[model samples]
Target: MPYTGPQSVDRALEMLDAVADAGGPVSAKALARRLECSLSTAYHLLAPLTERGYLVRTAQGYALGPRIPGLQRSLMQHLEPVPRMADVLAGLRRATGAEAYYTAYRGGLITVVDTTAPVTDTGNPFTPGRETRAHATAHGKALLAELPRPVLRRYLAEHGMPRLTRATITCAEVLEAELSRVRGQGFAVSVGEVDPAYTCLAVALPRGREGGRGRDGGAVHALSVSLPTGEFRRRPQEIRAALAQAAAGCG
Candidate 1:
């Protein structure tokens, strides 16, 4: 089904996506090419976005504007976890000596809402935004495992499973089998799927009256811990135990 809504609004949103995807300043000509529209039409779409502070015109080209951070802050406010969830994540990080993350599936996307500050300079890969590689992420898999088959199919159709690493499951059938295993085992694991250097283990938090519901009436929240692949493999039981404890605390 094609979008039957207003064309201008759809194109404006697409233009913003193009700018974000560029990862740097992008020119109107490049955006026009990406959006499959004329340069003039691109400018028309850019004008409102610029005026609205969603994009900024830089000497190099158009870049994400300051307003983007404000939107993120507002979103975080709404998506903030229960007060104790942060303490729970912090305790999990200390207990397992790994980065702890609290993720939620909302608006058809998985987002890391809260996380313990990186213990090392390596920094955290799971940030607070739309997580693209659901097929290769433990928190993503935990949430995806709870979705109904039809909703899962729609998600895969919209966001094709891209091979981020050699370990990433590119085949949908294989991923479905993996998700089935996650459902049976009550947890999800990502071993070098997103990055060969790291591994993640995650468990879904039980759904409650306060914890939001998903399309399949399953818990939308998940807790995950990430560590170096070697350390993760060496102490898999310890990591899983910490993750389960954190999930229970959050629930």
Candidate 2:
């Protein structure tokens, strides 16, 4: 929780950062190399966080714990951009009668900064501070598409695509093909990939006024709209249009 001045803790933080930058789960060995620490030392550093639930060990490997995203969201809630994004999402909800979410990508993972759900809808299952799936989500695909080709290719190679739902992209080849389409189209959409009943559409975040350090370092944000199945099927193009308009508003 609180960071006392311990070298081990510092190393642990470095390891966590490595995993986050990886954009997917990372192995202890990979994290150790990234942190430049011994394997034992890396596991030691990861232990406390895993126990506390800031990291999760899944069949795929180590992913960021759900709590970590929540913490980041809380910290970002104070920023001006997030509030503005919240306002945008609120308007999107009103306009489309659906759930809207704003996501920001800095190092590796794309995290939700805020969200708004229509009063009538049940709301998106994920929210501010939740970790959005990179493969199964429109925002995830959009973010990956935003990355430079070489960088994105390496990432996909290291983290093989896994099936989330029956609709989830199961092969790297297919996913990359779809990412190529997203790159050309300048946005990404999901049809029951994340959840059988949910549809999501996301657009690349408008590039902020220059001067920022990052990987792609171009787009710092993304706009996503998630809604129930039937409505999305009925008005797919309309929802995509709204998402694009919302992103276009960013200065």
Candidate 3:
């Protein structure tokens, strides 16, 4: 069966994602398969967007159009300021002596909002951006563990747990159990789940005051530190104490 809610709009968005994922203009047939729709449906979905300049059709196929730049600019203008999370990220870095990060969960995406000033000083593994595998990182798990049960379930349904390493929790049931433990412990830990040589610990930060208006506008954020696996294991107590103190001041 085809999508029922705002059928054309949903189909168009799916088509857009398919084209973008293809990394170039894609044939209507390939897009149909990617969208799990018929060739005719794919054309029908793309036609209006193409005409309206949301998409561009070339001899090869369709790509994002010029209008996208304007739209992106408009989006940036409406985004919340970045300053709100800067001070907190700086404080976390000083307290932990490790790469400190502030990540926000919103619209079913985990985005790194701010990182400490010296992100590369101690050889951090990750850069600030949207994370690919939420189930394999301490900060991702911390944010996931804080979500209400229903929302958590919805997120899992939309984005299944994908394995990133031998230690990643690929099963939903197991992940739920792990999140339960995270809740009880008041923090989340990832040991070689994201990187074979790294360990990370994270604690969920409360939404900001003033209705959570910074870095993606009310997106829930977490504080985290990454370390070499050996160092993390050796100084677990000390690192946890620093993380706890930093997390306490997030709001």
TM-score for each candidate, following the candidate numbering:
0.72, 0.64, 0.63
Clash pairs, model 2 backbone: none
> 1-251, model 1: which lDDT tens digit per residue?
22235888899899998898776999999998998888888998899899999999999999999899998878665554455887888899899999888887755777877788553444566765578888999999998887878878888888899998999999888999999999999999999999989899998776531333357333377889888999988989988987887777665
Q: What are the candidates' C-alpha RMSDs?
A: 4.9, 9.7, 6.6
Regions of candidate 2 where Cα sits further than 4 Å from its true position: 1-83, 118-123, 130-132, 157-159, 209-219
Q: Locate the minimum summed-lDDT window of 10 residues in model 3.
A: 208-217
- Against the hidden true structure, what lDDT does model 3 obtain? 0.76
Model 3 per-residue lDDT tens digits across residues 101-171: 87767756777766773544545666666676678899989988877677777778888787778998898
Pairs of residues at least 3 apart in sequence or in different chains that clash in candidate 3: none
Task: Show pairs that collide, candidate 1.
Answer: none
The alpha-carbon deviation from the true structure for residue 22 of candidate 2, after best TM-score superposition, in angstroms, is 27
Ranking by TM-score, best first?
1, 2, 3
Q: What value of lDDT does candidate 1 attain over all alpha carbons?
A: 0.82
Residue lDDT tens for model 2, 1-251: 23346876787787777777676788888887887777787778888889988889887778888788687656574322433666788889877887888776655556676778543343456555546467788887877776766766666665657787999997777888998998899889898997898888887675541344226433356788888889888988888788788778865
The TM-score between candidate 1 and the true structure equals 0.72
lDDT: the better of candidates 1 and 3? 1
